[model samples]
Structure formats: C-alpha cells, structure tokens
Target: MINKGANDLGGFLRSRRERLTPDAAGIEPGVTRRRVPGLRREELAELAGVSVGYYTRLEQGVSTSASDAVIDALAAALRLDPAEHEHLRILATPRRPTRPRARRSKLRPSVRDLLAAIPGSPAIVIDHRADVLAWNRLGHALLAGHVDFDAPDSRVRPNIARMLFLDPHHRALYRDWHAKAQVTVAALHQAVARHPADPGLEHLVGRLAVDSPEFARMWARRPVRTCSSYLRELAHPVVGRVTLVNETVTLPDDDQQIGLFYARPGTTDADALILLAQSFERRLAPGTPSRKEEAR
Candidate 1:
C-alpha cells in the first residue's frame, strides 16, 4: 500500500496511485481480494525497473534523489501527461538557494501597454502567487469590477486565488466553481514546487488553508495542474452568462503569466462582452457616481 508521508512528493504520489487501477496499469488482478487501494508499491517498482525498497524510500520521503531515467520510467508507468511529468520533475529536483521573491512583481511597461492594446478582450498579468500585477480595463471590469481599477498598482495587490475562495462576489462569478477551484489549487502546488523559496507564495497558501475550508479540502488532494488555455464560464453580474477562452502564456524572463480572455467572434458570448464593456464605460464616464458615492 502507498502511504503519503510528511513529504509533498509522497502526498502527490499517493493521490496519483489511488486513481490508477491495477487493470489500467495492465496488471492482472489476482484472485485474492486487495486490502489497500491502488497498485501496490512492489508492482509500481517492478514497472519502473527499480527495487521495491528504493521506491518505498522515495515515496516515504526518506530518499528524494531519483535519477532522470527512473523519473522517466515512473512517469511512463504512471501515464502522466506533459504538465504532470514536469511537476513530478520539479518535486524530485533538489532544492537550491533562491533569490528573495518580491511580493509585487513588476512587469515591463511595454507588456502593460500591450495588455491595453486589445480593447475588446480582457487581459491580466499575475505572479506565481496569482496576485494581480496588472490588468486591462476590461479585465478589471470582468474579473473584479467591485475593486478599484488601479488596485494592482498598489503594494498590496489582490490575489485571484484568495478571491476565488473567500470573496462571495468572486465565488458567484464562476458557473462551475468546483472546477475552477481545483485548477487554482493545483496551480498553487506547481508554483510552490518550482519556486520553493517564494515567501509570498508560501504565505498565500498558508492563509488560504486556515481561512477557507473549501480551499483546505482541495489543497489536501495534492493536485498538480498547469493549463495554458481553458474555457471559463462566468455568470457575470452585468452581462449574464459568458463563455470565454482563457489563454495564458508564461513570460520567459520571469514567472509571471499574462492571460487574455475572449470569446469567438460574432457569438452571443461576444455580444455579452460588448454589453459588459458598454456598462463599464458608462460607469467610468465623466461625473459618473462611483460605487462608494452610490453607497453613500
């Protein structure tokens, strides 16, 4: 039986193993009923061409230094996709002294300007901790209209992951909250593995774990997910239902990711975005009463 020890890698391995059946791994089930779930330690070790003792040590967090060939073999045996394979590699890699991570990461002015260039679509730049670093007007309107448009310019930036779990408005925005929650939590895990020394990311994870039971439940799953592009269904307060393709690209120079969300041209979804833009424009027009003013 595979058990997760104190190690994150061990936890991840345990989660993966639980989901993979012996029949799926092409192992014939014996007539004897199994007591523990998933492929046994010895079975997986045999498939990876490693001794059961060494594999057990690796899973138990006693030994983390696994060869590339062994990682590759294990990945193949487990049928991991590209992103999952990369995540596994990061977990197994030895930790090194990393430079201090700033709480608010700066983006080149050119990139910020680029975000504004696409007026029709919504775009945002976020750091590894999922803190909003910069956002286009439409992006702010779509994701966080309740927030000040210039919130990202401040020292204390709003974190998307935090809002997703804790803020009721943000939680209501997603049509499928569970799906988005899972992906967000998994991304956090990936970030921690890649940037082991990032204090900001560390704090975010700790904060969410304590404050949000939903986040805590998802975090315990030891998920690892990296998505370049996905569809997001939003129940926008102004525009009603919206389906947009969220495309994210990692900036080469830094760990920041820039994402643009847009719908296919000429669809009702596009029309919904157009309506959202119009409402936002009117709200920001000259002499328009602000949310605070209206509240007063």
Candidate 2:
C-alpha cells in the first residue's frame, strides 16, 4: 500500500513543478546548462516569492506548513488551474480532526421527499466511499435499471467508480470512458488523502488496482481531482447518446454527497433523455411493477 499522506504531498509538488516551464514562468534559460524539463528550483523560488532553500525543502516533502500567502504565490507562479490549486491547499494542509467511524443513520424524511419530487432529473445520494446510499426513481433507472433499488443494504448496489472501471456494461455506457475514468480515479485519489484511515476505501482501491490494469496505471499517476461539476456522454440502451452535466452537492451534516445529472434542453440528446424518463415511468406503471416484485 502507498503511504497516501506522503504521496499526496509529493505528487502535488511534482505535478506543479512539471507543469511550469521556464518560458511560461518568464525565466530565460541560460546558455551554460539546462537539465530539468520544467522550471528549475531557483526559478520557481523566484517566481513564487520564496527562497530556493525553502522551496527545495517543500519539494523534498520535509515541510508541509507553508503559509497561505506562500501557497497562493506558488499557485499563481505555477499557473495552477482552479482544481489543482484547491488540491494543492488540501495536500499542504493537515487533515481536519475527525471522530471514529460510525454507521450513518437513515436519510432525513425531507431529503428522501426531495429526491422523490425530482421526477425528471436523475439524482442519488452517496457516501464518501461512493456507496449509493439513496437514489431517486429517475436515478435508479438512469444508472442501473437491472438492479433492485428498495434494499439499500444489498451488496449488488452500484458504485459509480467501481462500475466505471470494473463492469463492462457500465464501461460501455460511457462514450468518453478514458476521460471519465481519469476523473473518477483522480477524485478517488483525493478522497484517499482526505480519509487515509478508511479501510473501506483502502479495500476498494486495492480491488481496483488488482482487477484493472488501466486503473492501476491511473492510480499510480496520482491525479487529484474534485467532483464539483463535469460533463459526461452516457450511451443509454433505451435513450442512446445523451450529454449530461453532473453536479455534486455535499450534505452539511454528514459525509454524504448528492449528485444531480442534467441534460441541456433544445437538443436531440435532451429528447432522448425525456424518452428515457418516460420509459422509466412506464416500467413503474400499473401492470409493470418494481424489481422488488420480480425478485420475489
């Protein structure tokens, strides 16, 4: 197992250093010698408004407590994208103090009601480990029509990342599987950093690393990504290809995440999504019952 804490810090510094070129950072390359690919330590220190020795120590993983001002300067100097910048902050800072793990209680009545009310949009509430804690009817239909929904404790419940890398059916559903897989692995990497002691997440990562060579390579790359929003191309069997935007909102009280998938209006993709919604409704109609009945 990788020492996630050290790896997170080392990976961020290395990524930032690799991305900043001498030309990009306005540093003139000397004719005498040039060995490093990106910005040299001295040049990066100059750009980041810090001493070369201090920056060197940081890059060496000898120190983690660079002030906010220093972090901002480094972020600006390296020209980090927003997500990368946020990830840098997370990597440099200490994990927030947390209590021992506990089995999360059931969702509040209001949240369940809210999911029920969203008839058209597909949405689900998941835990930190990407376990599908709850899902709206549309969400159930949109993602995994073959699975039973009523039994939340069922072992067969869909895990978004696991499905992305392990299940052929789910992999085929994604038109941009490579990009989606990268983001998924990156987000999981970030989660690993945040929750290093989570055995469940550790086990999941271990399983993926063993089961999928692509996942193993991507995990080795150590990309840190945040799941705020992203676009996905989903190839639904019934709906065909539909471009959807996924947004994640964190629940305040717990380590739960609510994800919403939306398709833009005034497009063929949107029409297909509507058809999918209608198909789901038909499946839930009088004669056609839920999967709970079929299993019995």
Candidate 3:
C-alpha cells in the first residue's frame, strides 16, 4: 500500500527540486531546449548517484524505500539549508499515530527575564504556533499598540500568522505588505509541516484558508520559508516609519524563541525605538493605565 506521508514527501521533494536551476546546479545548457524550470529528474538522479528509475518513482510518490543515505544525497544535490533539510527528513519519516504531542507554550523564567532586560528593543517570546507568549512593553507598543499586551496570553490569544492575514491593523503595519505577507505565509507553511499532527495548527490553517482569500492563494503555492534574522520596515502609527532588524533566538531544548526587533545604534530609527520605549514606560506609571490594561 502507498503511504500518504510518502506521497507528500514526494511532492515536497519535487517543489524543492523545481526551485533549483540547471545552471545553478553546474549543468551547462545544451542546444536542446528543456520544458521544466529546474533540473530534470534524470539530471538530479545522476547528481545524487541514484538510478533514474528510483528518482522518478520518488518524485511520482510511488516509492517509499529511500534510505537515509539517499535522502541526504537528495538534500545535498538540491542544496537545502538546515531547516529545509530537517523538513525533508520529517516528510520522509514514517508516520505513526496521529496523536498530537504535548505542546510546550510556557516561556521559561529566564526567557521572560530576557524580554524585560531589553527595554529599548522590541522583543517577544513566541511558540511554534506563532502565538505571542510574552512581549516586552516596547515589543507590544511597536508591533500592536492598538491591542493589549496581555491579550496574546489571554483566552483569545493573538497569533502572528493570523494577524498578518486577518487583522487590518497588523496588515497596515508593514510598509511592504505583500512581501511581508508572502514571508509570513511561507514561514507558517514550514511550521505546519513541522507539526503535522497538531490538530490545533491544522484548524488554524483550515480557518485561514476559509476566511482569507490571499491566504488560500499563498498556501496553495506551498512556499517554504525558514525564519531567520531579517530587516523589516514598519509604518507604526505612533513612531511613523521605522526600520528594524528582527533577530530570532531559538530557545535551547525548547520550541519557543525570543524575537528581538532593534535598529542600528547610530541611526534615527534607533532613536525612534528609544522614544517608543519611553512612551510605553510613561504610560505604565501610576494613574496611567498601560495600553494593555486600558484595552481590557
């Protein structure tokens, strides 16, 4: 019997394969024209030191006997990054019980302290589901001042992926909305693949697909993006135009991470961040309700 998981593995492989170009793979272009965008199945099979028949069967979702060595060769031939390689392994692994594993969403005390330590910088702790577990005052103010900081941890917790596509305020925050949206969707795609048996995540994806047309379109594209340090331009309602380098610190032995948003020290954007932090601090003083408390 053909395994459905193996079928998905095949599709994932094909997608990654198509992302590579023949020239990029060090293949010289011949006079004979090719049809597809990337390297042919035979070309890839040869590069991975596998039979063409085996590679073709793998791509067609009809083969499930690929060994670890074969998968590693395929990854190397496709030039997959660390995250992509991990993803490929997941797809190729045999699926057992679909029961969801216990999700660890609680932020460590040290991680929470780390967020408070970075006053001037906007930082947040998020789970694999992109749910904002905790955020510094500046982080709340910078990203979603209109919403409560405590709201994320509340019953109706706010997820970054959900807000990117569904919330008007969140959508307006990005200067390049479409580029940011694409990245957000692609990252979520990776997340979904990472936690395939998580029913909650599957529900989130289904809800987004039903509610947001743009999300459905992007999700259909099956774009895979691994989140890393990247620059983002935000049109904050309070701070106006601000650019920051968002760095993610993947927690050790945990599924949560702290995302720090900071501008270059000597720049005007850095100055803006400082000002925003100060404003949040002032709002937290006696007699003044925090933006979060007031929202409650």
lDDT of each: 0.83, 0.77, 0.79
- Selected candidate, larger lDDT, 1 vs 2: 1
Alpha-carbon RMSD to native, per candidate:
4.3, 3.5, 4.2
Model number with the top TM-score:
1
TM-score of model 3 relative to the true fold? 0.81
Q: Can you write out model 3's per-residue Cα lDDT over 5-77, one digit (the tens) per residue? A: 4226777788777889998899999899999989899989989999999899988878744688988999999
Model 3 off-target regions past 4 Å? Answer: 1-7, 21-43, 62-65, 79-82, 95-98, 102-104, 225-227, 282-296
Stretches of model 1 off by over 4 angstroms after superposition: 1-7, 288-296
Worst 10 residues of 2 by lDDT: 99-108
lDDT score, residue 140, model 2? 80
Best-to-worst order by TM-score is 1, 2, 3
Q: In model 2, state the lDDT of residue 203.
A: 73
RMSD of 3: 4.2
Query: Candidate 3, after superposition: displacement of residue 98 in Å?
Result: 5.5
Q: Residue 290: error of model 2 in Å?
A: 6.7
Q: 39-129, model 2: which lDDT tens digit per residue? A: 7888888988899999988888788667789889998998887887877777778766675454343566677778878877899987777
